[model samples]
Target chain A: MKKITIDPITRLEGHGKIEIFLNEAGNCEKAYLQIPELRGFEQFSIGRAAEEMPRITTMICGVCPTAHHMAATKALDDLFKVEPTSAAKKIRELMYSAFQAEDHLLHFFFLGGPDFIVGPQAPARERNILGVIAKVGIDTGSKVIEVRKRLRNVLRIIGGKPVMPSAGLPGGVSKGINEEEKQTIIEAGEYAVEFCQFALEFFDDIVLKNKDYVELITGDTYQHRTYYMGLVDKNNKVNFYDGLIRVVDPNGKEFAKFKGQDYLDHIEERVEPWTYVKFSYLKQLGWKGFVDGEQSGVFRVAPLARLNAADGMATPLAQQAYEKMYSVLGGKPVHSTLAYHWARLVEALYASERLLELARDPEITSKDIINLPTETPREGVGVVEAPRGTLIHHYKTDDEGILTDVNLIVATQNNSAAINMSIERAAKSLIKDGEVPNGILNMIEMAFRAYDPCHACATHSLPGRMALDVNVYDTKRKLIKRLQKNSCTTSTSGDGVGEAVSNT
Target chain B: MKTIILGIGNPILSDDGVGIKIAQQIKERNPDLKVVETGGVGINLLDHVIGYDRLIIIDSIKTGDGTIGDIYKLDLDDLDASMDLTPSHGMNIATTLRLGHGLGYDTPAQIRIYAIEILDNTTFRESCTKEIERQIPTIAGKIMREEQLCAIHTLGSPLCQPLQNRPVSKPKPRRAR
Candidate 1:
């Protein structure tokens, strides 16, 4: 048996390495998923003012700043025991949906779409959207650019800027939208809805045209069922902001539902020496490793998880898509992680429909957008369903509202174990005879990208000096190949181009 | 004609956010200036710099033995062939600028870099050190003056501010990475 290693996957966020160890017996010996550095954001946030957390924590990850901002705000609200007004909630939801649309678009088109469209071996220079424009039509490229701009415009109108919006606050948003701003949101929403629909059709066409890649879709089913968790309203509709925490099993069995403040009871985190990141699992079932487990405590979050946990989406189109997803994936408990992209696209459609509904709601245009908090508590926990997964922020404050402690569980952290599992499975199935099939490694990386893991914000480490190692072995447990790569291309300070190589 | 001033740094890592803070101040003073805060010089940097005619880059540099807040302005043409000036995430800013230049897409002709000398880069606190924070306004002022000079130079007008009167500081020593 031979071993193969690939260190520091390139064009991705954060610092992580995948190691596959096979023994002389031709069997898999060990699979190590290592994130070599620890970012103690929570520990360092102990003395800061809780009110500043929304902005402060937004620095955690550039890719998902909106999610961190929302979660931090929610967490502060919980600590203060303040509930935002209905209008405030709607505006916040709208802003988050816009962020989701933009983020998903970037991930799909710019980040992951290149591998699927241009083929994995394409040179890095030609592997981007520009390359897509060269190969496909200029129309597709322009459409992508147009969609991103519209989405960014929506975010700017709501959050005051596109990347990290300062609109979110403890009790409610810092400001409210005026008539003109509301109109802008409505127009953007209308355009976004139409644009998203067109993009979905385009993605579907891509999938249909490439029948060999259909397995990646899981036939419109919920792929990785495990246990689902998210925030859902009293009407059992999915919500990005302000809802109770709900968890369900693979068979769509409701196991537990708790208020956001009670999340500590259900979730527990485990640390491994191999990686700086920790694996969080359901506390009741105990730590059941990544691979085989009774679907009892294996929890999944983000778009797919949120969809599975909710009874139905607020919009008819989303409801229809959700039902179709359930029907296609054999009615829940999707074990295959690759199906997340489908769920993300479905949620994107749902978000667009929801945005349209909110825009048209007569109450949305009302000037009463913010409901301020009159008092403050010593602690709060804010939970929201980010585009990628469930995001939770817990903060403890002094009597004067100074932050004393901050705990954040981002979307990617919720899916950490599953991400490791998917990588291992993909490695085992794809790496053969010490040779990685073309696109196989890329497919495995794509599997991780499906989760859209934000390692930079999720983990605590500097940008450079990161390493990743992958090892593969044959059935006889003999080492076939070992691949080790660093993320930095030129400087050892880890401040260079992030490049990863798959060695045969 | 639209200007995007990208401030690149790791906020949690002390002075890395100097560029971003400077950009923010400029945006506040001049609403017309589009200010963006980025983590590093990567592919995202390339994306942000595209379409902007004037690029102002701010970052923290540990240039050997230079006093903190020493400002430096280097033309893109002066960059060495082997300089690893790219960011840690995507492509480097230098490469991106070069790429845009090669593509015949009229790259930013006026590029300015204001690098703050960092004493510490490991802290996770929000506020920077007293020395760096104090220099923010000074850096902002200097950048504004430079922009005026650039504008005047392009117009071929007589110097409003005497460039010779300002003390020419020594270039900071380059540290081995």
Candidate 2:
């Protein structure tokens, strides 16, 4: 049997190492996914002012600041018992949609796009968006920049800034949009919708052209059944901003729909000795281990999980795409996380359609963008569908409006268990005993990047360098292979690279 | 001439956000001073310093021997290989600064940086240790005095003589009921 270990998986957000131990018989014996850093965000926010949750939590992540901001705001709002006005809600939704559009575009094009477009084994120097741009020409790069710029402009109009907008407040937003701003937002929204449509065509062409990737598409093969979780509107349309928590069983059956505050009852965090990040699972399901099986509660989040949870897309084009995806996945739960990119594109289409609706809504032009109350309740929960997955921020406060506790479940946390599973599966299937050819390990790491794990923001750490080390040993306890790579340095852009590779 | 002060640091990461906090304090004293908070070394930095003729950058520097709150007046031209300025972002600050200079948009004519020596950058908790927080007021006061002195010096200089006695406009009063 052979044993292989990859320490500090490269191109990921946080510090983590994966070790795969195989016995003399060449079968997998044990797998360990380790996250080195401890999460102290919850404990640190205990004595802060309740109203500062949004701003404070925004610091949790530079990549997904909007997620932390929205969740923190929502939690504070719940505590305060403040419901923003119609215009306020509309503005918030628009800002969030803009964030979704920008963030998803960043992930799909800059982060995940390279994997599909550029072959995985391409030198570390040629595995970045810049490298892809050099090969593909300026037009593609300009498209991405244009999309991000337009999205940032839209978000700026409402949120006050593009990246970490300071708009959200406890009761409502701090600022309101005037007529001129509204018109600007409307124009930008129209442009975004058009851009998204163009991107859909672009992605469709790419998907059709790549037959190898097409095989990964579910339809009927691979894991296509698992529990689903997300938010929905009263009419059952997909809601990204706010709604009661809903969970559906593997067979498209509704399991539970509970208020956001009630999440504590169903979800319980289980700490594994290997990883610092805790694995949250259904309280009743228990830890059935990482292997795929019934009652595992190993449901994932992201585009795939969101699509599975919702009935249909809010927009027509997205709905059509959703139908196509469902048909391909054999109707419901898409367990194969590899199909997340397809789901992301479909959701991007949906977000564009939703933008058009909001832009057209007459109320969007109104002057009353903020509705804040003088007093608020002592505790609250804010939940939103972040680009990566569902994000929840729970905050409790003292009588004097001081924060007593803060619990955050970021998008990366939602996929914690699923990430481990993907790593294990990829490791077992790809790594042969003491040998994982160069770039094969990179592929396993790519599986984690599919979720775009934001360990920096999730754990409230400033962005830092990441290193991955992999070791392989033979049945005789002889070291066969050892690999060490830095996540940022390996990619040409000094950012994480995502590419697919095949080793013969 | 309008001056923009930028504070770049990770606020939760111990000493990172010190620059921003100092800028905020200076802004409170002089509301006209545009104080902006930024996460260091990115395209965002390029955007922030675009039109500023005079920019004051405040950040935390991990110099081996300097006292925690020691102030330094750095010359942009003198920024050679010897300086130990570390950008809080992934890319090196020197590289980003070089990129900005290469872009040829009017780089800051005079850029001053006040760096605080950092003790710890790993914690997520807010509120710097008492030693660091105490220096905030003194730093703010020093920056304010420097601006006033610079304005006076500029007025007195023969090269910038456009009528030194031009009436100083009074700041708009806060609206009262």
Candidate 3:
């Protein structure tokens, strides 16, 4: 028997499953993205000391630990009803900006970049960071590594470590930066800013210069018009560390802007039977069942959504990049899903610029970093624009600060509904009349990869890659084909495809 | 040799935290060894692993057909080094190592991987399952002995002495044998 295998499915075992139910005509009826979720986080949090949140939450993910740490620390600040000193906020924001820059750079060059940089139709072997290096030259790749190393050194200097930072306190950060440490960060920030500029030019030369790639970005197959959400400063500029939660309608008009604590008033989660991951949507609009556009409650969060929801970037260079993006894409609130990667680059520029700005601030080296909380602990919500998107940390406690309940609306959860929608849309648009092209797997994977959805909870085990399973069901409700991304593929051959796959 | 024992897993997840648990156990018997515990993967690992001579990575694996507490020792060659690490937060061990080498970062000269076959990694808890929890000390001892360090006596054993940072200080509760 010739080894019958699906190409991209075996390559990416990101633990993401796509179940496509086909109609009688062989067209896709429904496509469900079943993501394996780590269970009982709320149960895990209750009874722990509220102050331990910042440290404990960081362990929840292998990636985005910094994001979790920040959100949790902010939640403590809110819970204690204490405001951080100005210096502390700047120090925190500086660290956050560095993290965002490094993370976005990695995602672009490694995860999402391959689809466009190396060309989506490229061979599976060349669709990775190595492929990216092959195209962009070793010099750029070396530069990326250098820049990331410098930024991580800044993280180590301030956060005490790069992966999990213990610098956050209830009222403010645990420590402040001195002049020498500040100097190191300044150098890193300056170098990062330069690299981000190079990155924008690189994007122009690589992605934008390619007509086919641009069309794919703006194309309808990977597009969805949905309400966007993010954190915006008083001037309606994007801020990763802190800001009001802003929601924009599908037409790019501000729908609502409120404090982070008021998130419950706007957002709600809908649970589906097939998957542990809950679909979050606008509470006011109601759960309209995975539909996009204005009336549907389905909203999106993350890089693209942040760009769509915010008015502009905070820094000058990022603002110019932001303007260029909007002008090229035709307007605010770009509904193109693939544009998320483009928005990510724009945000990366802003993050790098913001890091430099914060580093240059004279107040960044102040000694007065933290303030003691006076009020008794109760319920509080802390929200930040994580590298992926809006991350919310909600905590309810008794008078003593023992956590009675904890809720974390991670970046991935916010985009779960939109991710499913994008996947289904791509599947429906690509899988016409039951042909079920093996090529469509990459197309569908590209849809989820746009958001860079990190399901690290259930993926802390070995193999180090997320597995994607594609199950295509016929009209008779029988399992026609099963592809176990990391293992093997068994097509619908009626000759015990299930048995042969099970044996393998 | 400047050996660094890296325990990679979510500490709160049952069985998933076996790596950290074993690292902690190894630390108990050999307090002077340079042991690092991290829930991070890919390039983030380069942050801790730079300048180390040997990297012994202990992680949890759920490969089918393995016993619950079975320990499988693997090297970099055992896994597909060029596997596409599209998702799962960052790059895999192979890619991270290659990237580190490419960038002229003094990554570990030699690497060893101890993948403990696990039963459950999804449930949110700080303790491993009863099956795997029992063999953690034995497993830790085996890994240390494999590294040419006597597990019983390390104070005057004249064995593997490494100098560095130990991030996670929380040790698992050890039972009397």
Candidate 4:
């Protein structure tokens, strides 16, 4: 009897390991998705000035600093018991929209696009952005780069920096966009909307049109019936910056809707001994393990969840695209994980439209920003829809305005339980009699990638690149097979990067 | 010739900030060089490094076998074959360079990557390990000498910017992470 361990995985945000345990009869017994936790963020945050949170938290993950910055800013506003002026809120939302547009565009094209555009069965080498360019043409590649540059420029204009935005403050943004900056943002927004529309069309022509790919999207292996969560405006429209946190049942009925401060009342984190990442579940429903369905407490977030938790998109063009997605998918609450890509594009369109609307607002240029806090600092909660999903930042400050305690239930953590469940379900349905099928790794990865889960945010790492490794074991728990990709075993004495090892 | 010096790392991540620290020093010493700092994202790195005739990238890397503060200066040919040229799912620095070349991005023909082996990167700290910190001036000095040699060879060329000697300023806070 032996236990096989695949310690590090590749092609993800952090180290994720998949362990498949076989039964005595050589059939798949169970599977576990384990994530390594980076330690001490909470401890490190203590004693820091509350004002430094936006800057410090953004340093956690280079990928989604904007989300943390926004969440922290909103939390500061709540903590100080101050309300930003109208212009401030609009400007915050404007920067947020740009962030979403840029992030979603990258995820769709560079991160998630290769899977569909290049075909899932394509070799590891070909299943990437270059492969996408080869299929879509080099002109399309240039356009992708061009559009991204413009979007980031808008971010730079608003946030004062691109990668890590510093515009957000306790009651408002640190800076306001003038006419020229507003004009640039508007142009970028228009281009983003057009590009996203084109992206949706491209998905339809390439992925939806192909019967095999469509089957893959609707296939049972990729489907999971789970509760969905997101942030919605008063009218139940998808809102990225500020909104009430909403939860919908598997059947698309509103289960609970509450303000940002009331999250703890609705959600609870479930800890497992095997991993550092905590699984969040509906507090009222209680912890029901990893099982899905109406009774299960495990819930999902990000694009599909957002689409399900809300009534419709706030913008007209996005609303149309949203309706089309639902009609094609056979109605609300799409459980198919593959559909996340489509939903992401739809949201991209919505974000772009929102960016334009905010940019065009007459008061957007007003100097009335930042309402100084007069109340004593205590505890406050702030939530925003990160490009991935609903992100909640809760903080408690001392009387002197120093951070005393901090708790973050990031969007990915909300989907942590469901992500594991999805992976196990895919593994069980696809792996037969201990036989690993072609594209099995991709199948498992597809489950997690849909979430675009940032483990780097949840748990930190060095080199900050995620490595994924999958290990299979026999009934006796003996090591059987290993598959690795984008791994970092390279000798860093600068000879070169590491070679990926794929072995069975 | 037009040249760019880039530093890549999470500045708050202890030893990982070594690259940025060195880049800052180099910027101080050579006011004429186009130096910038960034988190290690391939596409973003590509944006900054493109269109340059030469690029010198300073980064902190973890080589299990290397000692703390050891520096490795490497060229493109020195890298391994598995480092794909196209942008893959998680494109690293090597992949970004390859992608730049593949896309006909006018990528720097003369490029060097100085990887400083680090002992600690997991912790959240503003400073680096003392050992790595000690090497900052030496690394910056080395890079400056290399740039000077290149400038001397390329002097009088229309593409080359004028070289100037000036007193170094105190390091200022970086706007980027």
Candidate 5:
């Protein structure tokens, strides 16, 4: 049997490689996603002051710095044994909600939207944001840019920056919204809610209305029956910022709920020699490889997982949207991975509504934001629902507030095992008897794309965009075909396989 | 004419920070150039580049076509050849510009890219490779000459003035991450 490697998985914010082994009959036997690890992150943080973590740790991820910043700050609070004032909490949540809205909107329209909006089988060139604008009209594109801009502005006003926020402190945030800033944020949040509502309607009209797309969403290839995890408030409502970690089984039954500090007791990491990314599974259920079911410990996070783990949305409109989604999708604990898109929109609406609510609060403008910590520093854990999934930051510091040890469980790692399962399942099911159709690549990509994985930090960079090279081999482990982005061609001389086929 | 000198890269990632370092040098020499450092990619870069009459971008390139510290002066068309919509960081510049124009945004009329060939973008560090870091001022000077801005050497322009002190070595890299 020959091994196929798709080096540098394309269209995601990270560098991942998918290797599929083909049996003698040419059908797929096994597939694995290999993710390279960024070197020396733990060594990089050693000896750094504990207070600098919020700033330093946020740089770990380019896409979700706000999530890192929040988690690090909350960890700092726990480390110092201090609580933020009510005003500080509101201000922090305000910025966080805006970030959530911006991130979700980006993923849905720019990253993942083309798959559904422009049609799954659409040509490579037409399956992007430009194609999306072409189908939805230029006005909708402009509206997207406007809403995203407004949401970013809201983050800037509160966090004092556009991309990476620096407002988080041990006890609270460094800045608070003034009356004028409050009014501006209020308007922006209100607009965000409206924009998300419009987005939901658009999805309903275009995606749900199409029978083929619905069938694809509910298809067996994309379905995974496993545990789902997220953060929930006191009412067991979906919460992005501060809450206890909640896990639900495949049947939508509560598995366990625990504070952030108790993560090690409920979850465990398994390692493989082929990849640097550790596979995370439930501690109690034990590791069961890549299989998904109640028997298997494989679980997922991000939008769909968050929704399934929670009872309902916190806001009125988002609650309605949530109810509508479950009803249409055939009930709770929707196992379809493609439902992540719908769940993302519902989350965006919730984030927007929460932003507006926080913006309108009277205490949002209070000057007493930070409650300076007076206790000795030790170790603590902080958890937040990153737009991608649940993000956990744990740090150990000396009494001098100097960092001694640090460990971070990023959102993507939580779903890594499941992502591999999704990819393998899709690949096995889609590629039959050795003949791969034209759109096979996109179909395989659709499985992991739903997770919105971030691997840029994990892989090397090309000149501009990373080009994915898919190499197929024969039973003798000799190269058979080479399919690459932009120019897919048969191997001419090197690693000679067979005659050429140029699809792109 | 309204112009923007954009430096794009991940500052936390080793040699990738070269673009931003050069952009900062340019800003220090001539504050009137409207320099902006961004880690954003694809459409996010569009937001910063639009509404300007002319744009000059400094970024690190890994084309394997040149040696480390080798500089290439490219235009918008060159980027068109390098367009791969399936991107991890952000969209390629050409796609971003096209999207900006298609959406009826005010994209810059003239665009020039100064890309420095470099290695080691995967490491977590606050500084660029020493070889590339040494070329910051040179790259800054190249942009100034191309843009026809008042040179630091010969200038009584509004923003150009003789530096009271110039550090011989590369400036200590700040923790932008």
Candidate 6:
């Protein structure tokens, strides 16, 4: 027997690896996704002041700081047992909507959308932002960047977009928006709404109208009947900022609806030996391994899941987009993972519309933003629907308002099992008779990338800016091949963006 | 040229915060130079990066091949010329600058990237490890000197002073690790 190890895989953004095992027949047997873990976060937060969490948690991941900040602030509100004033809630939601809209748009243009915009089977070199720009025209990129700059500035006002202290405080925010600031938000919101509409039309023209792409989306290789989880408003409409957590069965039937404080009662984590991530499953369904369907406990979060778990969008244009999606994709709970991109577009539109609505609210410019807390501090849990999925922040504190413990279940963790399952299913479908296609890595990556799993601290994965890794083993557990896609220099020198290498 | 120093890193991720720390030190020494510290996500970089004639970006990178505190001055074109355009998950600096130029956003003409070799970026601690923490003043001074570029002296701004002789007090940790 022989073995080769890609040792010390650390320090890349969203650093993850896939290992595929082939049986004696040389056919794909099993595949697993492994991500490096960020250490000592609970220990790091144990002694911090309770109120500082809103600011501190923002540092958890540079990518989703606003999501974490919003979650942590809500947790503080619970800890002090005070409700935010009406104006404060609207203000917070306004900033949150901006964050979600900008984040989703970025994902569509740069992260996931390229797979469709540039066509999946295109040459590997032509499958990134530049490629997307080429296909979508230079103005699309310019529009995305321009709209994103405006929306991002609005997000910075509360979540410390430029790395200032957190403006979020318990019971409410620290301050209200002035009339001038509200005008900027309104204009930015309108611009985002227009861009998202254009984006949907682009999708309709490129993906929906194309027969081959439609078949690819509806194809079983990218489909799953897993339970879906999301946060929804009182009317069962998808809500990003705040709402009751909802879960729906594989058949698109309502299963559970609970507040953030009761999350532990409905959801639980299963620790697997092969990976550090704790895969989340529905508590009532029990742990049923990595299989999907009603018997399986595995549930998914993020765009597709949020839309599947809700009735409709809260805003009008988004509601139309939602209806059109279901009508075209064959109704509720579309099992196709590729539909996540479409769902992401609909949600972005909703977020933009909601931002405009809030921006226009008369109370948005009111001075009564915060309400000071008077209750004794203790334990509290906060929840918010991040662009990726539902994010939960749990905190326990001493009587003096100092944190005693902190636990976070980010979007990636909640979607971990489904992500792994999606990867394995794709690999199983793509590889046959022990023959692995050269393009199998991208094909398989498209499945999990749909979930946009950040692999937790993706705060930093300093593995020399590497992107994808795939390893294959034979029945004897011997290394057969290794494929790596890296754009980093091996040495501390310039001009060495290494090419993809495969060894057998 | 209106210049700005854009420091990029995660503040709570040990060595990853090195960029922010060095940027803060540079600002403390010369308040006249505009400094903005950010995690540098996607097009957000475009916002802080545009409207400046000259831009300096300092970030932490772990090639797993350099001294923990060593600084590497990188030109914009030296980046992965054909890779996906994103810093972490958004657009990479080179592609972003290209996009800015294409969009006619008044992007900086001269862009210098300072990548500090880092250790222990995976940890949740807000401060860098002791070894790297001890070298902050030296690293900050070196970057400031290189960035000053003699033009600031002609502008009547204070010269870049060696910070090694300045007070050697570390910021108080939220709690001892």
Per-residue lDDT of candidate 4, residues A10-66 (tens digit): 132344689988787666678888875656678888999988888888887777888
Q: Is candidate 3 or candidate 4 better by DockQ?
A: 3
Docking class of 2: incorrect
Local error of candidate 4 at A495, Å? 10
True contacts kept of each: 0.04, 0.05, 0.40, 0.12, 0.24, 0.24
The digit string of per-residue lDDT tens for model 3 on A403-501 reads: 999888988889999899888999898888777777777788889889988885434566676757788999998888775542222322221111121
Give the Cα-based TM-score of candidate 3 against the true structure.
0.91
Q: List residue ranges in candidate 6 displaced over 4 A.
A: A1-14, A156-165, A456-466, A486-504, B85-88, B145-177
* Cα RMSD to the true fold for all candidates: 8.1, 10.0, 6.5, 7.4, 7.3, 6.9
Q: Output the lDDT of residue B122, model 4.
A: 67
State every prediction's TM-score relative to the real structure: 0.77, 0.77, 0.91, 0.88, 0.90, 0.89
Candidate 2 deviant stretches above 4 angstroms: A1-14, A26-28, A216-225, A328-331, A369-376, A458-467, A471-480, A486-504, B1-7, B16-36, B40-46, B49-120, B127-177
Predicted model with the maximum TM-score:
3
Deviating ranges (above 4 Å) for candidate 1: A1-15, A36-38, A120-126, A216-225, A328-330, A433-440, A458-504, B1-5, B18-51, B56-123, B127-177
TM-score of chain B of 5: 0.81
How far off is each candidate at the interface, as Cα RMSD in Å?
A: 12.6, 14.2, 6.6, 9.7, 9.5, 9.2
What is the lDDT for B78 in model 4?
48
Give the residue spans of candidate 4 off by over 4 A. Answer: A1-15, A457-464, A486-504, B29-31, B77-90, B101-104, B134-177
Model 5: interface root-mean-square deviation in Å: 9.5
Error of 4 at A306 (Å): 0.3
DockQ of each: 0.12, 0.07, 0.27, 0.15, 0.20, 0.21
Best by DockQ: 3
Which TM-score value belongs to model 6? 0.89
Superposed model 3: Cα runs more than 4 Å off: A1-14, A484-504, B151-177
Residue-level lDDT of model 6, residues A58-100, one tens digit each, is: 7776677788888999999999999999999999999889888
Better of 3 and 6 by DockQ: 3
